[model samples]
Target: MLGRLNHVGVATPSIDDAVARYRDVLGATQIGEAFDLPAQGVRVCFVDTPNSQIELLEPLGPESPIAKFLEKNPLGGQHHVCFEVPDIHAAKAELEGKGVRILGEPRIGAHGTPVIFAHPRDMGGMLTEFMETPREGAH
Candidate 1:
């Protein structure tokens, strides 16, 4: 099943603005640099916290999934919450056995580990992402 809360994905129209807010206003110090995740169609950055991290996602293009999300809320907002799993495959099977509808096949995530998303409906409105735990020294 789920291990610990990994990171919360926040969709933003601008990753730079989000990063500034988290750093200046929110007083977050361990912010990571923004980078392109072309495969996910997003420009991402991470703000590390004591317990978990905050992932800032900005659409890479008009057709990016986050762009559609931005259309609904121009300012952008919380998109999804990711939790770590010891074994993603087993967790997927367990969730599926309990009738949860996963969104797609397991794929490499921003953390460089396999990930899968459970449907929002099954997760009670908020999209849920499951990421396999990274090995030592890995993100």
Candidate 2:
């Protein structure tokens, strides 16, 4: 089962611009440095919030998934919502039993936790990510 709302993923044409909006306009003070996840084909930066976080995702390359999303809506928009889970494998099995389509095998996510994505069609047109919560004291 899901534990908490982990983060909301936002596809953006530029992470810098997104960060500027969150900081200058929204008055957000806790923002993480941008980093590349080449394997995931995205450059991400996190805007920390009281309850959850916002993940700004920019295309890392022409073939990146975000690139296609940006092409559809040049301004970019919400991509997915991630939820925390105590055990990712258990969650995957439970969702699979319910006939949900899992995007792929659980893999190391941006948070350094095991994570998996569920197909949007199975989730009310919203792509969902399930991330195992990191153990206390672990970065």
Candidate 3:
């Protein structure tokens, strides 16, 4: 089962611009440095919030998934919401039993944790990600 809200993924044309807004306009100070996940085809940065995090996602290449999202919403918007899970495999099995369509196998996510995505249609038109939370100080 899901644990907590891990983060909200936002598709953006530029991470720099999103960081600027979070920093200057929202007064966020605990922003993490932007880094590229070439395997995932995304440039990512995390803005820490009290309860969760805001994941800024930008296309890493022309074939990046976020590129298609940006094309649909030129200004960008919420792409997905990640929820923490104690055991990813268990969660996957449970969801599978319920007939939910998973996007792919659990893989290493930007946070260096095991993560898997559920199809949007299966999740009420919203793509959902389940992340296995790392142990304390593991990250």
Candidate 4:
């Protein structure tokens, strides 16, 4: 139902500082350019690792979900983990059949693929995102 672990989403107060931390501190050199997802109400950057990627998300407005997360954890932390799926709608139906609670309807994700989030409560306290595999060259 799921492919490789796509990325680990980390909420941050500043994407710039987060990128710097990954570069100067972790010696990461494959950080993707930060971009704003106004529709999602956040700015996002990707720090590519050998195995997977680290996604840095900074809320664009106080009403963003990330901002609400920051209210509980001022320092910000792991927001969610995303996995690639061949078909998002199929995967959603499969998960629903198994009684997993999806947070909302599928929508365009950061990677320009359809995605849906499974509720944390139903996912053993971990918010899980399933994103459809991108087309060739989409990355």
Candidate 5:
């Protein structure tokens, strides 16, 4: 159902500082910036590395899922593990068929990708997001 670990989402209150720290100081390459979902209220920037990317997430509004997470945790850190999937809808169906609790339906994600999330309770207390990269010619 899931392919490779696509990226790791890290919640941070200050995305600017995080980008600088990871790119300038740590020497990671800057890939690009993106907004995951308006409903989710998250703006993310990617820091490229040899193997993967560092996804820096900042809440766009107080009601954002990340904001609520920050309110309780206070300390910003790794939030979720994103897995690359061949087909998001199929993956969601497979997971749901296996009794995994899905948070929402597959929707257009950052960079026009298709994605969905699974509840933490269904993933051994860890929030998991599944993403399907758009085909080269399709939006």
Candidate 6:
């Protein structure tokens, strides 16, 4: 049911510093950065690698999901695993139809792509994100 691992979400207090560290230490290059869906309260920076991507997530507010996660988890580390789907909206709907609770509705994610989150409880306590490249000519 899961698609390709799109990127690994890493919660960080300083996205620029994190991006620099990754670049200087691992030779990863920053691909892009964006702040989207203010309702979700996160600013993200994406770094490209040969096999995968590193997503640096910065919480926009204390009530943001990342903030809550940081309060209960480690200071900074992997947050969620994202799966690249052909159709995120459809996939989210399907999961909901099967009684899966969605964390948020579809919206433009930090990567400038359409994305949605599925509640961890529905997936064995693992937070999941479904993402898809916007269709051609789509905004």
User: What C-alpha lDDT does candidate 1 achieve relative to the native structure?
Assistant: 0.94
RMSD list, candidates in order? 0.9, 0.8, 0.7, 0.8, 2.0, 2.5
Question: Candidate 5: where are CA atoms >4 Å away?
Answer: 34-37, 137-139
lDDT of 2 at 127: 93
lDDT (tens digit, per residue) of candidate 6 on 37-62: 47678877778777778888888888
Error of 1 at 114 (Å): 0.5
Which residue pairs show collisions in model 3? Answer: none
Instruction: Give the alpha-carbon lDDT of every model.
Output: 0.94, 0.94, 0.93, 0.94, 0.81, 0.79
Off by over 4 Å in 1: none
Candidate 5 per-residue lDDT over residues 39-137, each given as its tens digit? 569988777677766778888889898998889777678899888888888898899999999987888766478889999998998899899965789
Error of 6 at 98 (Å): 2.5
For model 4, residues 1-139, the per-residue Cα lDDT tens digits are 6599999999999998889899999999999999999988999999999999999999999989999999998888999999999999999999999999998899999999999999999988999999999999998
Off by over 4 Å in 2: none
Lowest-lDDT window of 10 residues in candidate 5?
Answer: 30-39
Alpha-carbon deviation at 77 in model 4, angstroms? 0.8
4 or 6, greater by lDDT: 4
For 94-123, candidate 2 gives per-residue lDDT tens digits of 999999999989999899999999999999
| Model 6 pairs in collision | none
- Each prediction's TM-score versus the true structure: 0.96, 0.97, 0.98, 0.97, 0.89, 0.82
Model 4 clash count equals 0
Give, for candidate 2, the lowest lDDT window spanning 10 residues.
Answer: 1-10
